[model samples]
Each structure stands twice: as structure tokens, then as C-alpha cells.
Target: MDLDQLKTFDRIARDLSFTRAAAALNVTQATVSMRMRALEDLLGTTLFHRGRQVTLTDQGMTFLPYARRILGTAQEGREALRRVERGRVTLGSLRTMVAPLITEPLLRFQEVYPGIDVVVTEGRHTQIIAMLHEREVELGIVCWPNIDPLCLDLEPLVVMRERAPLVVSAEVAERLGPRPGIEDVLAIVPQVISLFWWQVEPDQASALCRRARSSVELPVEPALRLVERGEGVGYFLDSSVREGIAAGKLKEISPPEFGELYRDTALVVRSKAVLERPMLRDFALELAKDFRCMGRVIEDRLVEDVERAA
Candidate 1:
């Protein structure tokens, strides 16, 4: 009946445990139980079947969507008011893509809206999705093919796709010789530094991971560092390793068998209703514009590289 009761119900339903929900909501377990009991009494039905494992009853399942919608609408109203009065925008981004995707675009956003405050929270895909669902952030940048916005009730605003290249330290590249085949590269250096930020298929990803004699999984920054030290070869977004490649510290290898791999980064919002706010809309537009410009620059460079190779 009340927002607090509804929020408690929603959280409890999500976590499937009153104790866990209490921890997440920063309240006592007894308080969570009291709120849920009050809600179930008000509705004149048993919501959850209390037992060793917590499971939603038929009535609870029916009410879950309505509760989520009410909570979402309430949060959106609060955000709208905050946007009008304070000009604050919050964004969530994948930790690996932050440098390549966010830095320049954020600077551009700041230049256009100097008075507005922008907060960026970086996390992996699941964390970012949770932030969006909980209304902790107004926007999120996540890897595509890895995330399906429609299924998660998020609206995609922009998708920026870029090449993912196989790279190694200059020393390793020199050892393999120019125009090395996949077999030659594998024979010389069998260890691969794996980054799972982008994957077209689970099986394909697994196969790549298993190809090397040995593999070590790491986050983007650390993996890049290891590759730079000639610890192992890495498959990374071109933008992520561009500086290193240009500085002669890293080399990009394009073995004939590896072909081309691309990664897509998308900007998404919880709902299209959020975009009705002018300030948020402006910030979103600024980010999209910057990303488009970056895509063009990358494309131009690719064309130039092809012409020179020819």
C-alpha cells in the first residue's frame, strides 16, 4: 500500500531472502519481515511460501510486475525533480571500456554543461545492469551481444562498434616475423592473456580461451600491462591499445586465420521516459555525438591503413 512496503516487497522478491533484502536495504531482518507481513495482510493473500527455500506464491508472482512498475515510476519522478533543480546526471560504465569509451566523451559533456554535475560509476556488465535496474544511474555503457537491452527492459540509445585486434609486445612480434601465420604465432608464444569483455558466442569464446597452451584471465588494464611486458599476447579493442601501438611499445598482429573481430559498446537508459528530461537528453546527445565522431576517426584510420598496405 505504501512506497516503503512496496520497495521492501520488491527487494525481498529480488533477493528471495528477507535477510539478504534487509542487508541490501540497510535495515534489520525483522523490519523486512514486518513490512512484508503488513503488505501481505493488506492484500489479503499470502505472497511468499515461507519454508527452507523462499519462493513466490502465485499471487506474489502476479503482483511482482505491478510492484516493479510502481517503484520505477516513483523513482523516475524523483529523478525528474532532482534534474530540474540540481542538474545532476549519473552514468554507469564497464570498467574495461571506461578509458577508451568515456574519457573524451565525458570531457566534451562537461564543456557543454559546465554547471551540471556528472557522476560516472564503473563496473562489470552485471553490476552496471543492476545499477540501471535500481535507478542508481540514469545511463549505462555496456558491451553489446553480451547484453540484450530488450530483455532487461533498457532502451539502447547509441551503439559504437570498433575492431578488436590481437596484439603482442614488440619483442614478441619481432620474434614471430612479419606476416606470421596463426600456427607460427601459436608455436612461438602459446600463452594468451584473455579478456572476456566482448564475445560473439560462448562456444567461440571458450574455443579461443582453450587455444593457447596456457591462458590467464585478467581485467583490461592489467591484461594490457602484461601484454606490453611480453608476458602473453592479448586480444583487445583497437582503441584500448592504440597509444601503446603508436608509441612502439606494442604491435598488432593480423594472422590470416584470425580474421577480424569487432566489439560493440552501447549506451542505454532504463526507460525512454527518462529521456523526456531536457538536461539528461542533452547529456545523452553529447555522448552520442562524441562517440559518432570517434567512430568516424577510427574508420578513417582503417581506410588509410588499408590504402598504405595496398
Candidate 2:
């Protein structure tokens, strides 16, 4: 039977009088009797004894607990739907972008919305794009310059651009000397630690691969460690190398021949997903704000470097 019938049965069972049950339900006695008749017809059993005094039948007592459980579960579902604060936001990010770009914003998000759990899945550009296509993640952080053109559904919410500088250890920097060219740096530290996220032209990529055949290719985290330990020189995002350079453990080699290299890390979401799920929109907005602030910080740092050099 439906909720109305079950409710009427429960009310009559509680009051042990159809007249009082109708009063409690704010319905006429005839309506209550009609509901009872429909329920009994559906179950093929009378739920109440009709006499001078009303009383529940054996079947009615047996079914009461099950009906109450159904009503309770329905109420719980409604309550859950109404709770705006509790939810989960799944994010996919490049391993390189996570620590430098995502960690702080994520911590701040958690502080503000403790009830909303965030699950971050780390992957390469292709993998993150695949996750978005498959509806596995709502948000993603990826290098934007040479992204896959096929994924036209992905929308870039924020693009944080920063210089990508060649980082050398203090000893390697001394050997290369000030204003060292690419060839000079390569001669000194032949095996450059390459970052997977670097977006370069086909010609440049071929030349680097041919010249630095002995170079070890690695992701950002391990590559950073190797560079810091004087294992090899690394080309990294400015934000990634900032602390090391400030600590005097790493030096930036800005060779004019190599020109100015920059990386764009974008926070992207599936446009359709954002439209379908509004919570993702809210999360994307907050995250975009954080990345904008970070972009300003990087800009200020670059300005300070220029002034100090001049």
C-alpha cells in the first residue's frame, strides 16, 4: 500500500479509534475508512477488528514494524537530499601541479567546508582528460599549452602562467658561470633532468633529445630532488624552484638563447558536468580564486627578481 494508507493504518492503530485517527490526520472519518478498506483489499486481510471497541488484528501488528521502517527510510532520504553542506568533490591533477598549486587551496577548502570531502587523483594530462571524459572526476589541473584537442568539452576555469627556468645546483652554476648559454650549461651538466609536463616545439624537442641523450627523464617531484642534490640540472616551473633558489640550494640559469619559457597550469572542469552539478561550480569558483591569488604572488616574485638583477 501507499504512504497515505500506511499512515492512516498507523494513526488508527495508535489511537485505537478511527474517529480520533481522522482528527489527528486532519481527515474525515469516511476518508480514513476508505484508506483502511483499500489497504485491506491490497493485502487481502482485515487490519482492524470492527466491534464496540477497535483493536488491531494479528496481521496488522505483524506489518506495523515493516511499514514504520519504510516511512523512516523515506524520511532519511529526504533529509539527506536537503543537507547542502555534506558532499564529496572528486578532483584529478597532474602530479607536478599538486604540491605547488593544489595543496594550499585544498587545505583552505577543507578548513572552510569540513563536511565536504575532496578526493584528489593524480595522473598525467592524458589520464586526467580520460577521467573527465569518463565522468570519474569533476575537476582537473593540467598543463594547458599542448592539451588534447579532442576533449573540447573541458572548460578551463583558471590558467596560472609562470616562468619555467633552468635550475642548477650551486656547484654546477659556478662551473657554468654567470649568463651561461644553453650549450655552455649542457657542456657542464650534460645529463639534464627533464620534466614530463614541459610543452616545447617539435624541433626543440628533437634537438634536446638528440643532444641530451644521456639525460634522465622524470616527473617533477623526483626531478626536483635530483636537481637539489646536485645530481643534474633541471628545467622547472618558477613556483616549484622558488624555495630552493631562495635557500641558495638551486640557481636559475636564464640563457637568452633558450628564450623565456613559461608553463600554463589550468584548472579545468567538464562544462556539462558543471551544468549538471552545481556544487562543482561552487568548488571551481573558490579554487579559481585561490589560483588567481597565487598567480599574483608569482608575478610579484618575478618583479622582485627583475629589480634585484637590475
Candidate 3:
């Protein structure tokens, strides 16, 4: 009936030794025995068999799962209390992907709920998702292809269509004897920038391979930097390169489809994570709304495509 008594019984059952359990609980062996006996007597069940080596009875085995759950609930309650006192919402994201994907929505959410402190941890995409699934953070903004079904609750939101362009600095291009073709640029750039090929269909994959001169596998943004600085023509997402192009630091190559690569963004959290915290829930909703509104950015283009058919 008493939690302390049940706790003592649980520890004794786990260790199979009253002496060890007593030492663990910082109590005397006789005190441990007394608590266990009291618990067994109150429940009218003989929890453990008396012998040279202790073993659980059927009733004790049945009680084990419940005991673990009760202790877990207590720990969770204590942790939640600590989180409330701290007034912080911990979030995680892939290092390079979070800025253009979630930063604006996060800022807007902060404006609406200024009292909630938002702490962000950045790592690789896989690491970020693992932390989210493990409840290390409240949420994760990820740009991965597909998520695992095991331990996560996902909110899929297409924040933006990311397109990487094959870019070259004007100064760099002018220095070359002849401008490279798209396939040629890709092959050669990998040598200088290291690149990951995405969205290249099987039909195009062969062509890309034939022309690839470089074997470096750099991430998108850094690859673009290599291009802009004239090290090589490299691929980079439009969101990252747009500013540089506007500033006349980079120029897009003639390959029309080179800028078409894209990935969908999603918010991920542990399946059991409670979205019950009012301020935290509010922030999540605001972030979802901001992402949903992204579709409106190309509304005019959709209208034009529709009218042209008419």
C-alpha cells in the first residue's frame, strides 16, 4: 500500500538480496526486510519465495511492470516540473539546413511567446533526427528524404522547394578556354568541391558519371562557395545562392535543369512527447502555419500556367 514499502520490495526483488538492496537504498538490511514484509502483508500476497537464493513469485513478477511504470511516471513528473521552472523549449536541427527552413518561423514564434526560452542544437541530419526521437529535444526541423516509422511523430510541411544551381563566377568563367557543359561541369566540380548527387534520374545518371571529373563529395552550400570563388563550377541551392547572384558574385550556367533539385522539410518529435505545454504548443502551431503559407509564394505562377492552357 505504501510506495516506499513497494519500492523497497522492488529493489529487493531486483537484486535478490536484502543486504544489497538495503545498501543501495542507504538503509539497514533489517529495515529492508521489514518494508518488504509490510508490503507483502498489506497486499495479502507472498511476493518472493524464501530460500537460500531469492526469486519472485507469480504475484511479484506481475507487479514488476507496474512498479517500473510508476517509477517512470514519477521521474517524468519531476522532469516536467524542472522544464516549467526553466521556461525553455529545446529544439534540434541539421547544421546547414535550419536557417532558411525554420529560422524565420522560430523568430515569429518567439515574438508571440517571448517568455519561452528556445534552445537549439545543431548537428548532422541523422544525429538531429535521433535526438528528436529520443526526446532529447522538443522538436526537430529536418530535410531528410524519408523518416523511420519506429519512434517518431512527424509533421510534414513543405517549407520550400530547394533548388541547387550549377554556378560559376564570371571572373572564373572568363579565364577558362571554353565553357564546360552541364555534364562536364558536374564531373569536374566534384574534384574541386566534392558533391552529393541528388534527383539525378537513371537516364541522366550515366551522363553525369561520364562527365564527372572530380570525386569530392561536399555538401551543397560549400560546393556553391567553391563555384563562386572560381575554384570550380559547383551545385548549390537557390535559397543559398540567390543573394550571391544578386550581388554579382556568381552566375548560373546554361544548364536549365541543373537548378531543379529539391527536398521536402518536416518537423519531427518523439511519438510520446506531450504537446500540452501551452506556450510550446502555440509556438509549434505558428511554425506549422508559416510553412503552410509557403505555397502562396508561387500562386501567381500556378494561375499563369492554368490560364495559358485555356
Candidate 4:
């Protein structure tokens, strides 16, 4: 099957919308439909229901994981080949962190390293972490206190503080009260944390965010969607919720005991050997500086992430 067809299928399956997938892929909706048709023909089965709200067929459900894997492998191969070609660096990023943490720095990095191409692959928090460990990508940035590996096992390249807010859809916050307290939020809110964080022990912030009667373990993108729809509450990086809060779609809810919690945003690599190149080290430094600059508030606490493995 054509790699382009598989890529189109993967995007459509994830979004369940041909138009959105086409827009994201920088293609026309007609192109998206054609690709899907070509893929279905090759498979000899219909993959999606093609409704107003697209639903995957049984054939799609059975083939989805394998298609995802195939696309992943194709990406891996492409990146591997690019690296072998010289002056190229692949960075894995948590999808939520990209717009907030690295966009500006990445643009500047591209300017300085014009010869050294930078490619960023964004996945859910856990998938990005898995890519780092699997050696599919050279580096990853993840938010901490929620999706941490406990103690420096992930090879810390840089650590900076991020303001994580316990947030709810405006409707939920309204139900809680004009200015809801922890007890009120806990009575009404339902947590929507990433599935990767399901195993994360309840940290101080968790008490406020996850004290709800109901919960969901979804990826950041979908979790944000659910929160936007007023389906649940979640602790999101302050940057992640800024626009929604600004638009009155979501609101920050301070706990009775605290106003906000900090997440240690860690920039990590697979191994020290990967950073042996001075360029990688410089790139990490650039991103760290950018993040610290963008950190909206300076709290009393400063997180000192262990840099070198002990």
C-alpha cells in the first residue's frame, strides 16, 4: 500500500473527520477521500461508516492499530534515514507541550542551525516518552508531577517549572459555584487525565484535580476536547488552557489549600551518547531558556531536576 494512503488513513481514523484531516495534512477534502478510497480498495473492505460523524467499521477497528503501527514504522524509517544523511535532528514532543514550550525556540533553532534540519514528532505524553525509550527519537519533553518517571530514569536534559492549573469547563465551574472551592469542585467535577497518568500516584495537585466522583484516562488532545465540551475537569498546563479560559469556555479553579500547582517540564534524551554532539546540547539549552522565559509566574518553589544520571 502507498505510504501516503496509510498516512491519510491514520489521520482520518484519529480525527474521524475527512475535512479536518485534509486541512491538517494540507490537502483537499477530495484528495483525502480519494486516498481513503484507494486504501479501502487495496484492503477490499470499507474502513469507515462515512456518516455525518464518521464511525470506523469493524474492518477499520480491526485494522486501526496495525495501520498506526505501519505509519509509526514509516516515520521511524524516515527519521532514521534523515539522521544518517547528516545535519538532521529528530525531536519527540508531547502534543500539548509544543505550542506552549517549543514553538518559538524551534523557529530560532532552525534559523541558527539552518544546515541542521530539525524535525519534531508530536504524540501523546506517554507515546512521546515511549519513543524516547525506544530510541525512535533523540529527545522528548514531558510535563511532570502528573506524567513523571519518579527519579531521573528518563535521562534529563533540562527541567523547568510549568504552572499547571486545576481547570474545568465553564459550565462545570458554574455548577460548582461563582468561585468554587475544593469541596465544591470535588462534589461536581470529574477528572480527565491522560491514560498514561492513570498509574501516576496522586500527587499534591492530584488531590484537587482527581478528587472528583468520576474520571477519564484519555490522551491530552481528547481530554482537552472533553473538558471544552464540559464533560469533565482536568489539571492542564496553564498555557494549555489559556485560550479556552480567555474565551470563557474553561476556567481555572483554585483549590482551598492552594491556588496553583507546578509541573516540572523535563527535556530528556535517550542516552548521554546522544548528547555527545555539542549541537544537541546547544539545542537543549535554547529550548530550556525559551521555556523559562515563557513561564508566566515565578513561584516560591524552584524545581532542580537532576541532570546527570547518578
Among these predictions, the greatest TM-score belongs to 1
Ten consecutive residues with minimal summed lDDT in candidate 3?
A: 297-306
TM values, all candidates = 0.64, 0.63, 0.55, 0.57
Compose the digit string of candidate 4's lDDT tens values, residues 1-310: 8888988888988899999999999999999999999989999999999878998999999998998899889898998787767777778887667877777877778777877878789876677777776776787776553344533466665566766777778888777876666676666655545434323534655554456666667767788888878777767777788888999988887766655565566677666666556567567767767767656433212123223411
Q: Count clashing residue pairs in model 4.
A: 0
Residue 204 in model 4: lDDT? 58
- Evaluated against the true structure, the overall lDDT of model 1 is 0.78
Over 1-310, each residue of candidate 3 has an lDDT whose tens digit, in order, gives: 7668868877987799888899999999889888888888888998888789888999999988888788778888988778678687877866555555568878888887777668788876667767777778887766644345544455443344445555678675554335555655544344444343332223333344456664455666666666777767655556667788898888766554333444445555453234556566555665566545532232112223223323
User: Which scores greater on lDDT, model 1 or model 4?
Assistant: 1
Q: Report the lDDT tens digits of candidate 1 across residue range 140-228.
A: 88776445443467666676777778898999899998899867777777788777775343343456567878988888878888888
Off by over 4 Å in 4: 1-79, 124-130, 143-155, 171-175, 186-199, 203-213, 257-260, 270-278, 294-310
Worst 10 residues of 2 by lDDT: 297-306
Q: Model 1 — TM-score against the truth? A: 0.64
Query: Cα miss at 84, model 1 (Å)?
Result: 8.4
Better of 3 and 4 by TM-score: 4
Query: What lDDT score belongs to each candidate, Candidate 1 first?
Result: 0.78, 0.74, 0.63, 0.72
| Model number with the top lDDT | 1
lDDT of 2 by residue, 7-74 (tens): 99989999999999999999999999999999999999989998889999999999889888888898
Identify the superior model by TM-score, candidate 1 or candidate 3. Answer: 1
The runs of at least 3 residues in candidate 3 whose Cα sits more than 4 Å from the true structure, single-residue gaps closed, are 1-83, 144-153, 157-159, 173-180, 183-210, 218-222, 254-259, 271-276, 289-310
